[model samples]
Target: MNGGTSTTTATPNPSTTAPSAPKTSKPGRTSPPNSNSPPATATAPSSASTPTPPTASARSGGRTEHAVSPRLPHGASYTLLALGAALAAAALSFTALAAQFDNNVYDWLFRVHPAGHRPHEAVLLAFDDRTLMDHGGVRGLRRTLASTLEILAAAPPRVTAVDLTLADPGDPAEDARLAAAMLRLPGLALAAEMLPDSSGWQDPRPEFLAAAEAIGHVHALPGPLDEINRMIALERAAGRDRRFALALEAHRLALGGGAIVSTPSDLESGGVRIPSRQDAGRPLRVHYRPSSTVETLPIGALLADPARARALRGRVVFIGVTALSAIPDRLFTPLSPLDGNRPMAGVEIHAQSFETITNRSFIVDAPPIIPVALAFALAAALAAAFTFTSAPVAYSLGLVLLVAAHTLPWLAFLGRLVLPPFAPVAASWSALAACAAFRFFYVRRQLASSEQTTARYQQAFHFVAHEMRTPLTAIQGSSEIISRYNLPEDKRKQMGQMINAESKRLAQMITTFLDVERLSAGQMDLRSSSFPVSGLLDACLRRAQPLADRKHISLEATAADDLAATADRELLEYALYNLLTNAIKYSPEHTTVRVSATRDAHHHLLAVTDQGMGMTPEEVKNLGRKFYRTERAERAGIQGTGIGLSIVRQIVDLHGGRLSVESAPDQGSTFTIALPA
Candidate 1:
């Protein structure tokens, strides 16, 4: 029996919910109508029987001499497999693509502008050791401010921004002087440090506040979850006003007259997204210049005491500490993780902020679609790969994909380009591993079941073949005796014919039953050899002629003598014999049964053509199914057990040959076998 569709087919139970039985007649000549015989067709293999070729529509290939079984009748396995594959594909696709996650949006507001970009544009008036030496400790602070005020008055900066907070004055005189100096400058702005808490309060020393009318609130953006600087917000909330970020504020002040760069290109990111604490975005572009380059410098120092008490003039001057652990300190920057960790002075933070805000060099974001798509695609692929691939290979491939997705986004960001980031590469990979593992185990279980069923079928075939041998032999012997002792000429001839007919029928029944069981059980063995196929065909024809002669069906061979191949000789012969016998059996009484063999450039072909009550297209479609008789064939009173062609298909497959059929209900049927030359 061809496992072709047997494993995929089920038997209709006669006792339960059976269809209406077709009418039948007693067997004297031909049955009046249909009997219990499946319509037979050309041989097809027991394996796959999908109609890749048009002929497959006519019949399935016969079962090969291998562990072949009937196709399973249930569609459950196929449905489940398809469902699993789709799900796996979806999951793998996602994991391989999507990107969306980002943490902490408040950080972008608190940009530490780099001094690189605004070097010549801003001045840093430090209350250094020299300035302090020129005066005294508390008194020196006074001299430094008095001097700064002197320089600012001479050459007023575009807009002086004093990055100083005087909540607590170590020296009141210097603080007072600074306040006095601020009042003199027409457009000087004093930075007020906002409280780090949610209250959003500022700590501008009363002295400084009383002197300077405008307060430039200074607040660093919130750090990402990982403490990295990746984004900064354009807007920030202050006491009563929704204020621009420090960088924005500085830029606004610089362009107070509204004559600086106006393009979106001027601001990094156009202040769209905020940074995540996890990491800083790509580095900003900066152009640092010495304080002397700006008008707010040492009033007049083309080349004085190179590093003097007063060098800043006509520019934004920020003052702060630079020592290690000045106060509650944190000075991390994106320049380099290891170096950025060191505590930084307040003045440098202002420098960084000023440059960054002014330069507008910032990190772009990962696109929204990139991450989402990646997640879906990777998830699906991983699921499928895990389903079929080995654990190590699946994991390894998954790892590579994950790394690729992750690295790709990061690299794009570094290049000032945006891509998606929220991809579930890691998750998808793991899921595939898990899913594939489950499938691996599942397939093993199914294989075990199939193997067990096949073994049981083999046992049944052996037992049945053994059990039927005795009765068949007895019937043949009895028929022979009755034929030999005929009383009259007509009686003798009739008896002889009956004996031959019965003996042939019995033998055929036994062969059909044995072949079906053996093929289904996968117990058949092959004796392969290269031989003249012409001789084999001749032998099969001689053996099948008696049956053909009885029916007045003419059988003839028409194969090219040159055709030959290296295949299982016995199996090939049996398969060929089966095809020829079927042609003779189903053929109309007067039709010519023609068998032919030919060789092409790449293949050797064998064909059997019969003019008989053939099959409809639909009936031809499922030709090799065990016990599946065509409606037309059954209507023709064909005496068949329905396992012959199926067994033939099995043998053909075992020899690496193909079987196909072409037939129409009214037209004669033709079966072709192709073997690679």
Candidate 2:
């Protein structure tokens, strides 16, 4: 059980695990509790729990807790990081930023698309400066209105909503003519204004109001910051009096005049159901068409040519004084002229609002969560591309993301969904910037690490090459002496032996260096075969005997003669060569180095122990780090390139084994390699 536990604990889950996606809950749109409705709050469904992967923190905690799940490839980690940043930015857009940026983007989209379709039934009759001058100023304005109404009454329009607020009494005689004309027309609905203070509503002269078929409020609320009129309130209240908007009343009367009927949430008249704005109780968003789309005629012309009024027979005629001097009667609109000075006439604004209601072309918006979710998803995609792809390809993908962000809004606009462009564009750009930053840092880190490794390897290569010269020089000198001189048999035999030993050492050094290179480059595949553990240990001892003899150290091995391992024989031999050689090189003269193999039920342990100047725990901890050598080893003039143990560890890992070190200052050291039996 203990052995099983140890094995289970030793091996870890793969390092490639990452979170599949960001775990976030979207807030559903909720309505405030109405006096007659139950109190309630709506929340989006919660996300599922994410799998935790073992990270540095997890390992240090000795458990999987606090582990960050790895859902992305190692190179694509930047993509996930960017997604997190995009979500944060999007959330901020709703709070501290207050969606100002988002609104601005929407405003831009609104202005860029000006050519729009307007309802065919709504028409504008402007009492402009030209019409006023052609008629005879304010004294004649009432006559002009009365005359136009008479002409409209002759043919009878579907509905005639005079946007004129005839609040204060007009000339009594002229008012009588207007009232008479209004009474004669059953399709006529007059406009009125309600005071913000809930004071009594204002309407045309009492006689004129009494004579009109119906009365509707003409007051509109401007947008909060810009004071732009984009939406028209469907209804307004003045104390006990509830009045519908001019557009709503006109629409109702146009469907055939009758007692206006409506429900708490909608206006219903003559079996026509017009849905009211209920989301957050916001006013209906006006889908404004160009000012030119509302067929317009000067009020004077209609009065001058009574026959021309026949063309206005089936339309809902909106009559208002748009003369610049006629009270500067204009408001800023989304489709306002590009010059920024030309505001749409109040009459035209009313026409557009009424047309919007009649045609049911009100603008809709996607849920707030949509743009946010899409932004994060795009950011993730960009991050992944930036991480795994080349610079040109990643940049191209980023461009694609940008185009996608901007284009989606236009498509949504076509569908009458007012999807703000800024959040997505801002999110995508922010994500790209974040991913770019990550790529920059990632490249920098890799370059710095690579440069450091190169420097260490270059230095180690020079040292090892220098060491090779000594053995090569010995072989060359011994061989040259044997061939060049007529020496005694004993001296010749000794020289020949020296040359042979030096040749063997040189060949082993070359082979080990080549193996290290191949392993570092990931080109070495294990060539597995079964071999006796004793044979391997004995071979390592024999290889190190000459070096151990030079230091007057005894080499010893104790292992089961029958025990064997299933791994590449040549690779194991190289690993043991490094271990045994290091044991001999680091130990003091006359010290003994012990090699032993022991097995449990699941694994075999091969330990190399040396009674030498041991290391501090810190030193032992750093033993297998490439090119890491202790200060004591440096001071003691030990000849080492510092990568031998690194190579040994790599080989053991390739053979599905683990390397462990045990050491303490002044207590010697033990290096253990554990492999499955």
Best by lDDT: 2
Give the lowest summed-lDDT range of ten residues in model 1: 44-53
Sequence-dependent TM-score of model 1: 0.45
Q: What lDDT tens digits, residue by residue, belong to model 1 across residues 30-50?
A: 212223542111111111111
| Pairs that collide, model 2 | 17-70, 18-69, 18-70, 18-71, 19-70, 19-71
Give the per-residue lDDT digits (tens) of candidate 2, residues 1-677.
23222110111123423223222212232224344542221111111111111122322323222223455565557756777778776877576344556556566677887536644888788898889998898778788888888888888888888888788887889888988888877777888888657777887778887877778888766667676777777777787887888877888888876555556555665666655544444366777776666688888787778898889887888988888787555778766655355777777777878878777776776778888888788888887888778988998999999899889988898777877665678788888887878778978998998998899778768867886776665655555544555566876775566566656666555555655665666555665778888788877776666566655777777776567889877767767777777877788876788888889898889898998788988888897777688999999987565777878888889788999998877678899999989
Instruction: State every prediction's TM-score relative to the real structure.
Output: 0.45, 0.63
Native-to-model Cα distance after best TM-score fit, residue 216 in candidate 2, in Å: 2.1
Q: In terms of TM-score, how similar is model 2 to the real structure?
A: 0.63
- Cα lDDT of model 2 overall? 0.72
Candidate 1: list runs displaced more than 4 Å.
1-160, 167-172, 183-187, 195-200, 203-214, 221-234, 257-317, 333-336, 344-347, 366-370, 381-403, 415-423, 453-677
